[model samples]
Target: MCGIFGYVGDESAGPIVYRGLETLEYRGYDSAGVALRSGGSDELTIEKRAGEVAALSVPTVPDAISAIGHTRWSTHGAPTDENAHPHTGCDDRLAIVHNGIVENYEAAKADLDEHTFTSETDTEVVAHLLERELDSLEESGPDSPPRDGSPGRPDGGTASREGESADAPDSSDVAWRVRRALESVVDRLDGSYAIAAIHERDDCIVATRNESPLVVGHGSNAAFLASDVPALVEHTREVTYLDDGDVAVLTPDSVSIYRDGRRVEPSISTVEWDADAAQKGGYDHYMRKEIHEQPTALRQALGSRVDVDTGTASLDVDFPQGYLESVEEVQFLACGTSAYAGRYAATLFESLADVRATSVTASEYAFTGGRDPWRTLAVAVTQSGETADTLSALREARGAGARTLGVTNTLGSSVTREADDALFIRAGPEIGVAATKTFASQVSTLALLAIAVGRERGTLTAATAREHLEDLTALPGAIQQVLDREEQIRAVATTFADSDAFFFVGRSYGYPVALEGALKLKEISYDHAEGFPAGELKHGPLALVTDETPVLAVLTDGAGRRESLNNVAEVQARGAPTIGVTTAGVDAGSLDVAFEVPDAGVFSPLVANVYFQLFAYHVANEKGRSIDKPRNLAKSVTVE
Candidate 1:
């Protein structure tokens, strides 16, 4: 996954592109670059670096009105200056920035033996191929095939050319030539891509996407292109989501869209989030800011969805009156943190909605399948809504005739558009690579979703629903109590900073929280952490425990509390230090380290999770690890 930002505007483009890249830093990239060219100038200036966006020095280009920037995650080559983006053509007249992979790049490269390449990247081949395509268009008319044995002519065998002579090409043909060249280049590309191009002779920016995300920001005097909404949300909230095979030509005043060489109308949608939500504010790191914002995020998710007095939930999505009642089972498909959240929701669905619910990891779901599609309700849980594997799984479920619902934070993400129905979690822009507030918000929304389903199925009485909603309403204050004990959590983290590994054990609803706690530790602290059901510790994991290992257990006043405490006793008997996250009924003297949470019935895990988050954050801080941008992890998995 990478970030792309481009601008065609009246003011200088350097600062806008730079700030946009900063917003996308959480997407995880190793290299940064920017290509700037003034409206009337024929020369392009390129600056790049192999580190973070802040490391890339941008020269003052006062007159530059159009530019494109990229933050690249190492894919084709290692992070090096030569491998950075904004790659140029052999003639040095055109520059291209791209995200996603080109599967046929080697074949494209083999044909350009005469041309010299500077970078060891698949993207460089496209730049050279574009140059060759332009050369062919300039030498021969649009009807002639490429002499380099590239892909053949366009599908219709080229345009009429309006009777223009093949021997001589006019200046007016340059725009047409660029368009045709891009078409030919895309035809040869076999994999996913989102590409933006700029030529010295043209003042406009051209972009296209296939199996990758590309959006356009529509402004009064400018139009911009970016890989995601946050990049350009500050400048304009109105955006056009580009579909596969769509080409957009953007100038200062207009954006003309074309699909398969035919002009098409654009679908413009408005984004509600302000740019301020994406900022770190006064917090030291974006992750910390998000951790503290969990209360507000939870409130936002439950605002209009819950009826506090009546103890009922109303999901703000299109659902046929009896559709939910007819569902015999519920299947959840997701990846990573979202998958963990789905696991938590699955437990609630089985108990509250009285349905068989199971969470399947999105990538592995296709290989293992035995379900009655007609009676199963498939739910896709994702934060960005653009996760590749989750999207694929949702499509597969739909093809099997299962009703699909997308539970996502982003409004216009691919999952929202492709699924049969959508339930938005309303957790505004989350910029941290390691999810925090969004996790809290997702679980809260799923709780409400379970309540709504139960109410429709007549499985949950009004009094039971009231109790659940009351617990949900108190989650914010309960989590705040945990955040207020940050210094205490820091002390605990400092004590366990020397541990080699961590083992987290829980049961029932606490099981998913245990998994998520371990995930947070592994993600931010770079520690080897494993989560398992409490009863399974003796099965295999208990043998790995040593005095140097820290055992963290989630035990509350619930059905599994006794079994969880037995597991904790088993760990303590092995001389390992035990840390228990529990409610009031569980005594603090029972464990070596006790992190207490307020008693909230089945919702106790929500409060218990906050302590684990704070503990992980402090531990990562103690270890001097990168808190926000962990190595080899991206915020959104746009690529499979």
Candidate 2:
């Protein structure tokens, strides 16, 4: 998950790019860069570094009105100046930045043997290709040759056939040359991307996306493209989600779109969320604020997934019916918190639909691989939809001849573009790095897909699916009921504030919650927390129960999972002070603490998982870590 922002309007590019990336810090990145084409100079001036954008001491932006910036979550190479984008072609002739993985980079790299490279990035290949195109376009443009005085280079020009570079273009010729170069360059790309380019000769900004997200703000000349919405919402609520293979060129005075070499009008979408929704709202940290936002967050998601007017629950998804018919078995693949959602969905999938389901953690999917179990279906789950391991597994499943479906929150995200069919998790933009609302949304989408399958196979009555969808629609209220207990959780976190080691135990569906609980604390809190299947205690983990390690147990009463409380008692007998996540008002005072979740179905993942996330987040915040941009824990893993 990387943050990308561009401005082509009258606003100052520096502040816009900076503030935009600040909001996107939640996306997670290890490096940052900005390329701007000022009104005068043609070349794109770029300053990239190998560290958090928040930590950067970048130089002030030049006086140009149009600029583009990127916050990179490393994929092709290590975090370094040479590896960060915007990557340049030969002698900075062309510049580009990209957000998706190019599966055929090795082949592209071989073609670049004659060209010199300054960065070890997959994204740089676009620059090289663009440079080649620009070189060919130079001779035929309205402007005969690019003049001198570019931004990155005070002088700009191309290299001669004999290998000597030509003089740099002057300021007046920058815009025309840059635009022509880009038009030619853009035609050669073959993979997923959301691209924004600064042509040195043109007064405009050239931007586009193919199976990637690019949104144009409602303002007459303003435009934005991000993997998600919140980054651009600061400028305008009226927006458009660019279609697959669509190209959009933006300028302060104009915006045009194209599809498969033909011009087309893009559909506009209005977003109601305010910039303040992306802010922490007086909370100590964004993670804390988002964790508390789960209840309303869940409700908002439910509202989007189902149409209130029709009372007919639909995925609100657009895909060919033929795609669904091709799917058979489903392998639910994801990493970390998302994987738990996948596990719950696997159960939901099998019960609601006539399909067999297998849940696999992305990290281990390859190792467990082999065999034609059936004409398989791959359902990849991710909050950001950019997880590296999951992407590889999706490709692996596809290679195995399975139909692929993507369940993700980010529209135009990589997984959505790759899948044969996709169901969007209407979670909006999840700002907290540890994930609260996103996790719930993943479950929501997966469940809905299951319902959709049930509808298809006739296993689930349409009325039953509709009623459950209605219940799902009401889940926001139940979620809100849980968020009201934030103060209570804050108080509880203080109790374990000084503890270093912890144990999380649960049974049944709660097992994943316990595992997720352990994961959240370990990721950001720097705590050594272990999650066990409760029943696995006697096998080995029980030895670690001690006064020093606070034991967290899942005990949701009235949820048919009473056996978990027995293990909660077992831990207490061993002198491990316990904290339990259970249904509201179930008193387990002997357990030292009990945080509550409303009794829900396997839909319980929608509530309980969030509560545990809150528990971990508060503990980390109490320890004073950057909860939103956790150390070494990225919001999205986009490289394998």
Candidate 3:
């Protein structure tokens, strides 16, 4: 994870590009840079710093009309001024910013001995290669076409269009040259990358991506390119997601796209989210704000999709006709918090839909074999949709002849495009590296999908479905009740903020929430934490319990509560302090501490999770940890 932003419009480009990069700060980066070019000349100004984007010494380039910015998360080299992005060509005629690795950079650098290298980064090799490519294009006359002789344009049209006189080539022709140069360099590179380059001779930005996520924002007389939607939401919601191997040329008044060296019409879609959703509002951090926003997020995710009157669940997914009915098995693949969400969904599908469901880590799923291919429904759960492992796994599942479904928050993410169908969680933009609202939204959406599948398979009766729908609709209010107890959770957290270790134990659905809570605690507070099923505690984890280690248990109002309470007693007997998260009526009499959530029927886990979120947040805050951007973590896992 890195962040990229580019702008081509009539307004000052530097400030716009800078603001776009600021919006993407959540993605996490070590260095920031911007390249700007004046409209009247080839003069380009580059300002970069090896630190936060705000620390970058951006100059006032009021006349610059085109710009590209990058927030580099170090991959090929150390985070240093010389290794920062916005790398320039040897001749200073081109500036480029890139995301993802170039596996063949060493070989390319071996061939670039004739050119002087200033930085020890793989990205510098790209700038040099593009510089050579552009030189060759200039050597060839304006009328000379690309090596393939396909008119050097995607559409195979001549430089001059119908009704326009065939005249001397101008800046538009330079735009073509830039595009062709990029295409040439793209063919020589190996491995994943998203490159954005602006040449001194043209007021355009040429961009291309292969195995990395990129999107173009279309606005009135302006166009934007970014690695994520939030970077462009402030200016315009209309965006065109670039598929693999697609090249795009953007200018103030136009955006032309190409794939496989042929022109393709871009599908423009509007983002329904308001820009203010990504803002922190008055909250201290985005993580805290999102933790409080879970109620609204769940409400939006459940809005109008389920009908209690009809006793049916309607999920916005496009499956082949009769696909859900014919499915024999289900496999959910995801990573990190999404994996936990998938784990919970797998249980829901198994119990509600009466299907064989399993959850697997996306990175490891390619090696596991039990897939029935045509009979298996492979579901990928990813909040960002651009997760590299999930996308790769989805493709692998497709190659194995399994139909795939993507559950994602990002509409145009690679997973959404690659999978056969997409189910959007509609969590809007989650800016914190530690996921909050998206996690809640994902689990809620998955529950709805399970209900829909149950109805299709005749496993869940209409009356039962109606009852579950009512429980689902009440989740938002239940989460609000939990949020209302923030002060109580904060007090509990302060009591254990100095604990050296934490243990979370739960049964069934609560098990996944326990795991997620431990993960959040470790991520933000830098504490050693482990979450395991309550039944497994006596197997080994009990040995780690001590007075200094607090054991947190989730025992909702259900059949599993008694056994979970027994496990809590075992931990308490080991001299470990205990904290129980349960429904209001449960008597957690033997626990050192207890947090009560509303009795939300089968959906009480959703409410209990909110209590854990607040507990983790306050723990991190009390420890003086960086709660928003945790060290060594990025919001989106774009690379394997």
Number of the top-ranking candidate, with lDDT as the measure:
3
Residue 516 lDDT in candidate 2: 79
Once fitted onto the true fold, the runs of candidate 3 whose alpha carbons sit more than 4 angstroms away are 145-171, 367-370
Global lDDT scores for all candidate models: 0.85, 0.69, 0.87
Name the weakest run of 10 consecutive residues (lDDT summed) in model 3. 161-170
RMSD of every candidate to native, in Å, equals 3.8, 6.8, 2.9
- Backbone clash count for every predicted candidate, in the order shown: 0, 19, 0
True-structure lDDT of candidate 2: 0.69
Taking the tens digit of each residue's C-alpha lDDT, what string does model 2 give over 1-640?
5667777777667777777777666655788887776556556677888888866554365666777778887767998988877888777744677776676776787898988887777788878877765665454443234322121222333322232133222234444355445545555666656676766555466666654445666565566655567887778887767765665666676566655544456667678667888777898777777776666666665665575344345665664555554455678999888898887778777778877788998877862355453357778888776676787788777777676788887665668778777877666566777777777777777777787777776677867776667667767777777677777877887788788598887776677677878888888788899888877877887778877778887776322356666776777788888887776666655668767677665555456666677778778878887777887666765545
Task: Quickly count the clashes in candidate 3.
Answer: 0
Predicted structure 1, TM vs. truth: 0.93
Judging by TM-score against the true structure, name the best candidate. Answer: 3
User: What does candidate 3's lDDT look like per residue over 563-631, in tens digits?
Assistant: 999988888888999998888887877788888887776778767888888999999999898888787
TM-score of each: 0.93, 0.79, 0.95
